[model samples]
Target: ARDGILVVRPDSGELPKIVLDVLESLAGKFGTSNTPTGHKLLPPKIRVIQGDGIDINSLEMILKTMTAAGWAADNLAFGSGGALLQKLHRDTQKCAFKCSYAVVNGEGVDVVKDPITDPGKKSKKGRLSLEKNADGTWSTITEGKGDPAKDQLVRIFLNGDLTVDEKFQTIRDRSNVGL
Candidate 1:
């Protein structure tokens, strides 16, 4: 009846139903109360974390279900298992890798389109490079100006030939990104 902490993790089953079921189970065991905002609050000593079958929609649905049932949002946590990003297609973010700028007929040209139907579909123009701002955040700039030697972007290939290829693991390690 005495301990440091207790965290119940449920990683299997359909998310929307399972999450609510777990919340009800916890309430039945550890009990719950109404918050000042009139939402059900779980006992602070215990909490639940769900880690599977979660996407943006599912996450939103879970939270909505919890709130509808009077459960506080703090009663549970979610782990996406990288699905949040991995499951996304380029179109989900409105990303199109078309050549926004290119050299044509020995002349520099800025190419872009601002569709009247969807203004958000407008793309950038001219050559682009990421530059570090004075506040340490990155901003995309057209027509590169920073010193080529110091900037972080590296050239790996040119002219349809692999110039600086590395193993997949090496690339992941070098970029410090995990998937």
Candidate 2:
């Protein structure tokens, strides 16, 4: 007969005021709805997962303190372990791939590293060019002095070849276009 909705995770405390005191003690013991954007929502059998200290700034401060106390971000349901994948690495977001332009004997070289004890690990020298401005914003253009007909960069490897394969939903619909 197990119907459904009985979530209630909670895993430890202080998570944005204990997830609004466990969603106001589960909406005062099972009961609540009012949402045409007014918020509140908590009773369809009972929910509220939260999974302890989740990240992204404590899940946007617990959905902005549960929508400023009125509630309903669909009444809670978030879970993250090791802050969504064990504290990541590669400088945890400063990421790195370096190698800005190189050719060697045929001469093209611009490559840079710039380290005197980390100038924010500076590295960017030539051949980069991204460009998509005119207010829409997106400028890279380092050394190789940009503008290869307003390059939007699309080569996807060449020598060992795989020159553009794409199709992971066409690179997630080109990374969700303007979203």
Best by TM-score: 1
lDDT of 1 by residue, 1-179 (tens): 79755778763556577788888888898888888999877888888888665788888999998888788999888876556778755445766776667667878788886654457767788777766566667666666565454455566756578888789998779667322
Cα lDDT computed for each candidate against the true fold: 0.74, 0.78
**Clash totals for all models, in order?**
1, 0
* Clashing residue pairs, backbone N/CA/C < 3 A, model 1: 40-70
Give each model a TM-score. Answer: 0.46, 0.27
Error of 1 at 133 (Å): 58
Candidate 2, residues 146-168, lDDT tens digits: the string is 67898888879866789878779
Task: Using lDDT, give the best candidate's number.
Answer: 2
- lDDT for model 2, on a 0 to 1 scale? 0.78
